[model samples]
Target: SQQGEEDPQALSIQEGENATMNCSYKTSINNLQWYRQNSGRGLVHLILIRSNEREKHSGRLRVTLDTSKKSSSLLITASRAADTASYFCATVTSRLDSGAGSYQLTFGKGTKLSVIP
Candidate 1:
């Protein structure tokens, strides 16, 4: 599957600590997206980094992508208990056979993070 696999299926850390998660994909992609999902809530888009971009930052979150290695990493600094959630990495690949602007998005099983205050 072109979907990425997240490392350390589960993680636990204290508040104010930094949390890092890694993802590896099997094929080429147009972009990679990170999403956060609370226990019973829907996913919320965290960030999106294009294949042409190597790194990006949003508030306390930082993401890095290594196209050559087909991998990516997400880091959350000064994590809080509210940061606890399931994090997923989704990869977008263009569909060559499909008409213009067609693409497919694949998501990983996700990494569950728990932050203790």
Candidate 2:
């Protein structure tokens, strides 16, 4: 029952098709970030969108945040086999313990995406 839980736990699509993933959180956030991880590799940062922003794009990836619904979605256009990985959404929230500009990050379980060639 934690914040930042992604839906459609797994996804499968053909190469050149699009892939979409969604994440939902429970509390207010300063910003949200997306990351991708290969089977046996570390996570790679994908994109970050501020709470004030509605949508953002980087290359073939498009991210949209809906503060009103406390949810966000990631869309990958023309997904490739190399893009097969687990994608996660993390939320950044302000710390209440007077941590002096420090923040807390909570990540979703992630959606496993498999791109078929």
Could you say which candidate leads in lDDT?
1
Steric clash pairs (candidate 1) = none
List the candidate 1 regions with Cα displacement exceeding 4 Å: 97-101
Pairs that clash in candidate 2: none
After TM-score superposition, what is the CA distance of residue 16 in candidate 1 from its true location, in Å?
0.6
Candidate 1 lDDT over 1-117, as tens digits, reads 648999989999999999999999999999999999999899999999999999999999999999999999999999999999999999999877887869998999899999999
In model 2, state the lDDT of residue 15: 100
TM-score of 2: 0.96
Model 2, position 115: C-alpha lDDT score: 98
lDDT of 1 at 107: 96
- Backbone atom clashes (below 3 Å) for every candidate: 0, 0
Candidate 2 lDDT tens digits, 1-117: 367999899999999999999999999999999999999899999999999999999999999999999999999999999999999999999878865978988899999999999
Q: Quick one: how many clashes does candidate 1 have?
A: 0
